[model samples]
Each structure stands twice: as C-alpha cells, then as structure tokens.
Target: MEFLWTSFEIVGTIAFAISGALVGVSRRMDIFGMLVLALATAIGGGIVRDILVGHFPPNSLQTGFYVLLTLAVTIAVFMVYRSKQDHHMSTRWVRRIYLTADTIGLASFTVTGTSVGVYAYPQYPIFCMILGILTAVGGGMIRDVLAQRVPSVLREEVYALPAIIGSAVYYVFGYDGAWLYASYGSFITVFLIRTAAIRYEWSLPRVY
Candidate 1:
C-alpha cells in the first residue's frame, strides 16, 4: 500500500507539472520560465502538506529524483506542445489537454494526500482531510497567483468542493478495511464530478 501510494504521488506530480507547463506555453513563457512554473506547481503542494504535518525537509526535497522528474516532464511537454503549434493544432485542442491534465493531477494528488494523512496520522482525520484538499489544490493556487489570475478553486464550478468531499470520503472509508479501494474510489468520484461539472457548466449557487 505504501508503494502504491508513492507511485500515485510521483505520477500525480508529473501530471501536475505537465499541466503547469501547458499553462506556461499558453502564456508564451520562455523555456526557463515554463520549467520554473512546472517545478513550483509539481512540488508546492507536497511541500505545504509536509510542513503542515511537521514533516521537515519534505519528501519532495529529500527525493532529488522528484525534482529531476518534474524537470524532465516539463521539458517533454513543452517540446511536444511547441512542435505541435507549428503543425497548426487548434487552440481548443491545446486547452482541452491542459484542462484534462489539470483535472487528473487534482484528483490524484487529493487521493495521495488524504491517504498519507489517513495512514500516518489517523487520529486527526479532519486535519488530514484539510491537508489533502490543500495538497491537491495548493499548487494550482500558487500557479494562479504567480500568473496573476484568479485561482480556479475559488470559483463555483464544483472544483475544490470535489477535493474536500473526496478527502472526507477517503477518511471515512479508510478507517475500515480496503484502504486502497476507498481512496481510489474517492479520487475517481472527485475526478468524475469535476469533469462533469466542466462539461455541463455546473456551478454552486452563490447566496450573495
């Protein structure tokens, strides 16, 4: 289970980095800036998660491999995307790819954070759940801040809500047997909900 969780974390990091790189590409950022953004988005959430849990040095820091992986993924994504523009791919296709990658990263990281919190510190379920939500969305929040745009998590389209709900479900089901099943189910639920919300243009009603 630990190995599985770690695998998910690494994949999630790569996915998020790719998403960040895509955003950078869209913004016409240079290669160096793209790499920087990707690295920040990939590792920011994990760093915050560790700090919140008092895990100094942070797994993202200790594992140099993760940094290398983020760099490699970013470069690869940038290269592929840059080349495709010359071939005249539609802007809509590029946007779809970015959004899809972002959603996957959001779901995967949410599960990873929640699972880690549940396994490592089951006594504080609420804190763990919040950490999970933060870990899932924190990178994008930072990216949006750096990019001078409104963070998507703050909007009504069932974005952060799905992460919160998934994290809570992970905590609840994780208490029983079949932790992996529960965690994966929660992740899929969040992903599907977010995807549906995007596709159907669903939004939470504002009381104001």
Candidate 2:
C-alpha cells in the first residue's frame, strides 16, 4: 500500500510538472522560470502536507530523487513538444493536456494526501479531507501564482469540489478496497465535470 501510494505520488508529480513546464513555455518564460514552475507544481503540495503534519524538512526535500524526477520530466516534455514543430499547438491541444494532467494529478494527490492523513492522524476525517484537497490543488495554486493567473481550483467548475468528494469517498471506503476503482472513479468524475464546465464556459457569478 505504501509503495502504491508513493508510485501514484511520483506519477502525479511528473504529470503536473510537465503541465507546469508547458505553461511556462507557452508564456515565453525563461529556462529558470520554467524550472521554478516545474518544481513548484511538482512538489508544493507535498511540502505543504509535510509541514501540516509536522514533518520537518519535508519528504520532498529529503529525497533528491523527487527533484531530479521533476526536472527530467520537465525537460523531456519540453523536448518532445519542441521537436514536434509541425504539430500545431492549438488552444485545444493545450487545453486537452492541461485538463488531463490536472485530472490525474488531482486524483493521485487526493489519495496520497488522504492516506497520509489517515496514517498519521487517523482521528480527523475533516482534516484528512482538507489535506486531500490541499494536496490535490496546492501545486496548481503555486503554479498559477507564479504565472500571474487565477488558480483554476478557485474558479467555479467543480475543481476542488471533486477533491472533496473523492476524499470523502476514500474515507468511507478505506484503503483496503480496490485502488483502481476509487482513483479512476474520482478522476472520471472530476474530468467530466471540468470538461462540461469548459464546454459551457461556466463561471461563478461575481460578487460585489
């Protein structure tokens, strides 16, 4: 179970890093900026989670492998996109990648965050749920801040809501059940909601 959780975290980190690096590229950011975005988007949530759980130095900082992985993934994504000059990177392509990355990362982080909470605290389901949402969205929040854009989770479109729902589901089912079922179901729910919202251009009403 621990190994499976770590695997999901690594996968989510790589996917989110790729998405963040792509954003940096699209925004014409320099190499350093791109790397910064990649690192933040890859490890920010784990950093927050560690801090909240009182894990000094954080697991992300303790393990150099996570940093290397994010860097390698970012570079690989950039190379792949750069090499494909003939492939037009339309808004649709960018949107598709972003949505896919966001969905997968969200689901993976939700599970990881909830698992950590359950393992460490075990008594606070609300805290576990909140941590799950934070883990799922913290990196993206940091990425958006660095990019000078509103965080997607803050917008109305059932973004963070999905994390909340998924966390609750995990709490109810516990970790003993089928891993793929919970993870895939949560991801599909989030993806469908987000895709529908985008298709309809839905937005929360502005409050004065």
Candidate 3:
C-alpha cells in the first residue's frame, strides 16, 4: 500500500506538471511564468493539504525532487511547443493531451490524499473525503486564479464532482476494508467520469 501511494504521488506530480506547462505554453507565457504555473499545479494541493493537517512547512517544500521535476517538464514543454509551432501544430492536440494527463493527475492525487487523510483522521471520514477532493482540484483552482481565469471547479459541471465522488468511494472502501486496492478503484472512477465529461461535454444547468 505504501509503495502504491508513493508511486501515485510521483506520477501525479509529473502529470500535473505536464498539464500545467501545457496551459502555460498555450497562453504564451515566458519560461519563468510557465515554471511557476507548473510548480503550483504540480504541488500546490499537496502543500495546502499538509498545512491544513498541521504538517509544518509541508513535506513537498522539504524536498527538491518535485521542484526539479516540474522545472524539467516545463522546460521540455517550452522547447517542444515552441519548436512545433512553426509546423502549425494544432492546439486541439495539445488540449487532448492536457485533458488526458490532467485527468490522471486529478484521480491519482485524490486517491492518495484520501488515503493519507484516512490514516491521519481515522475517525473523521468526512474530513478525509474533503481533503481528498481538495487535494485533487485545489491546484487547478490556484492555477486558474493565477492565470486570471475562472476556476474550472466553479464552472465545470463534473470537474470537482468527480473528485468528490472518488473521495467518497475511497472512504467507503477504506472504512469497510472491501479491497486492498481501494485507492486504485477510486482513481478509476474519477478518471472515467472526467473522461466522460470531456467527451460528452457534460455541464451543470445554468442559472438564469
């Protein structure tokens, strides 16, 4: 279980970095701006969760691995994006790639955070689920805010909802000991829903 959690953490970090960098590249941000967005999207949620749980300084800040990883990804994206623009690379392909990668990050981070929250607050299942949802979408919210855009969670119908549902699933399975790989199950649920939202253009009913 520990190994699985660690694996997701790294994968989530990389996926989030790539997704954020993709957004920056599309926005025509400079190298520094892109790096900043990538770093925030990669680890902002984890930092927020750590602080909320009273973990001082946050474990993410204590390590250079995530920072280095984000930096590398941002630079790589910058290089590739800039080089390919001359060939008229379509933003459609970029959007498709970002959606796929971001969905993975959302699900992975949510499950990992829920697992950590369960261990931290065994008696408070609700708190665990909340932390899980926050861990999943908080970074994206921050990213959008920094970019002067409305956060997707506020407008996208099924965006944060998937994470919320995933966290709930995580809580139930973990509480009942239904499976050894509950986290993975929750991840799959979130990923599938997000994919559906993108494919079907699912949206909440608009208020008049």
Write down the TM-score of every candidate. 0.94, 0.87, 0.94
Task: Return the candidate ranking by lDDT, descending.
Answer: 3, 1, 2
**What is candidate 3's lDDT per residue for 10-42, written digit by digit as tens?**
888889999888878777889988888888898
- Which 10 consecutive positions of candidate 2 have the poorest summed lDDT? 182-191
Q: Any idea what lDDT model 1 has?
A: 0.84
Candidates 1 and 2, the one with greater lDDT: 1
Give the TM-score comparing model 2 with the true structure, all chains together: 0.87
Model 1: CA > 4 A from native: 85-88
Q: List runs of model 2 lying over 4 Å from the truth.
A: 87-89, 175-208
- In the range 45-104, model 2's lDDT, one tens digit per residue, is 889888899988988889798899988988887777777766565667876887788777
- Per-residue lDDT tens digits for candidate 1, residues 113-149, read 8887887788998887898899999998888878777
**TM-score-better candidate, 2 vs 3:** 3
Better of 1 and 2 by TM-score: 1
lDDT of all predictions, in order shown? 0.84, 0.79, 0.86
When summed lDDT is taken over every stretch of 10 residues in candidate 3, the lowest stretch is 82-91
